[model samples]
Target: MKPILLDVPLQLETDRLFLRAPLQAGDGDVVYEAIRDSINELKQWLSLFQTIPTVEETEIILRNAHIDFLKRESFRYLIFHKDTNEFIGTASLHAINWKVSKCEIGYWINTQFSGKGYMTEAVRELINLGFQQLRFRRIGIRCESTNLSSRSIAEKLGFKLEGTLRNDDLSADGSKLTDICIYSIIM
Candidate 1:
């Protein structure tokens, strides 16, 4: 099996977005605001939902992610609107299984910025990075079945639906089992 983590800096840009490596410790404020502003929207999908971070806590979060990036176990990116360079969302490829040439992608965009095709563009660009640059055979995205918009993005990106995991998520207020619709693209 080949090692997935490389010393090379990974960066991808679409016509409308700047998709680069995750932020460093100095970028805590920006990350905090991005998460805080979109907390309400993110809570709907993520299992480990939390209240908005304060400036201090945000610094800690950035430091941790930065360290993870250095370790090469997970890769997280901050989505930036190209025209305005505005922070839009966060995306990550986690649990990378280099031996199998696979990884799980996770993302969340601000509610206010939803439905403008920003995420779709980001995902497509990221998929290319995974398949072409990283030598990945398949990339998977799992989202709550109720998240219609996310599912639509997966479909738009040419991922084949691989069925659902019944009641696989427990978070927020209830223990409702979320049907995780797995979508994959084999390169």
Candidate 2:
């Protein structure tokens, strides 16, 4: 089946959070704020946040993300608090291979929300969406081996450590080589 014909939900919910595609025009403001507040921590793992982005740049990124979501090229959901409607972070099912029925999950949380298990819960929902709703045969999470927080999410959710690739990629800042840990769960 063509991925474009698939009916993906615009929003998904958990007890404390809601995940939605970046569809609204002003969505970037909140996302930008989160990025600004989390930049110090985010820069360690995510290259995109190596420098703080202006609100306009962030808005453009989100707008493009909306287009990607519609095209089924990738699904980037902005995570938010359920009751307060506060933006918390983002979780994405990306690097999709439709014929292989697989994709990778990528995520980050605002520093203020870290260590609270919000990211774990949000990722758990994405896993369910991939296997059950998207019918993906395999979903993987690949992160820097030093990123214990990310590795923990995959482990806590029962993803197996498929392998670790030594010196697999450059660090987010391109300063040094880093090992990559690959984790996966099959439906």
Candidate 3:
């Protein structure tokens, strides 16, 4: 069956968060601002933010995300504070393997929202969505071994450590080799 025909929700909510696909046309501006505000911290882990992205570029990305969501190619969600209606971070179910019914999750929080537990809550919801709604057999979180915050989120959510890939990739800055930690929860 074509993935595009798969029925899925565009949004999911928690006590403090509202997670949704980039359906709003103006969401790119908001996402761009969050990236600008969090660039320094984001650059530490994500190679995508090594250079500041223009608003137009961010918008294009968001538009693509919307298209991807419709095609069921990948689901990238924008996180917002429920009460405040503030953008807090980004999360996604990417690296999909439809045949295996699995995907890897990735996330980043706005620097201002760090340590607030919002991301953990958001990711927990994503895991649930993957298993319950998407019928995934496995959901994984892969992070740089040095990123304690990222690793802890997976651990906190009960994802077991599957293995570590030494020298899995380069650091965001391309200055050093980085190890990748693989954690997963299987149904």
Candidate 4:
């Protein structure tokens, strides 16, 4: 089936959070603020913000993400607190393989929202969406082996650790090589 023909939910509700695709024109600013506030921590893992990005640049990326969502190439959602309507983080069902019904899930939360189990809950919902709603055969998550917090999230969700890719990629600072742990669930 052409993915664009697939019925994708515009929003997903958890107990305290709302997950939705980046469809609003002004949505990028909120995400940019979150990244700005969390850059010290985020830069340790993600190289996407190696340098702080301007609001305009972030908006462009968010706009492109919307296009990708329409094409069903990848699904990037901006997460928000249901009650407060505050942006909490971002997550994506990316690196899709429509034929195999597989996709990789990635996420990052604002530092202030960390340790609250928000991301864990968000990821669980994505897993359900991927397997039951999206009808995917496999869902995988890859993270740096040294990132215990991220690895723990996958374990908590009952995703099995497939293996560690040694020297799989560069460290966040690009100063050295790092190992990556791949975890997956197959339906």
Q: What is the C-alpha local distance difference test score of candidate 3?
A: 0.93
What does candidate 3's lDDT look like per residue over 54-125, in tens digits? 989999988998889898989999999999999999999999999999999999999999998999999999
Per-model TM against the reference = 0.90, 0.99, 0.97, 0.98
- Candidates in order: C-alpha RMSD to true structure: 1.9, 0.6, 0.9, 0.8
For residue 57, give model 3's deviation from the true position in Å: 0.4
Model 2 TM-score relative to the real fold: 0.99
The window of 10 residues in a row where model 2 has the poorest summed lDDT is 108-117
**Deviating ranges (above 4 Å) for candidate 1:** 1-7, 172-174
Off by over 4 Å in 2: none
Which of the numbered candidates is closest to the native, going by highest TM-score? 2
Candidate number achieving the greatest lDDT relative to the actual structure: 2
- Write candidate 1's Cα lDDT for 1-187 as tens digits: 3363475355678999987776554677777777778888777776455567688876776677767777777778888898887888877777788778898777888777889999989888878778877778989988888888889999998999999888877644455656678889897
Name the lDDT value of residue 18 in candidate 4.
Answer: 90
Q: Give the TM-score of candidate 4.
A: 0.98
List candidate 3 stretches off by more than 4 Å.
none
Candidate 2 residue-wise lDDT at 50 = 95
Better of 1 and 2 by TM-score: 2
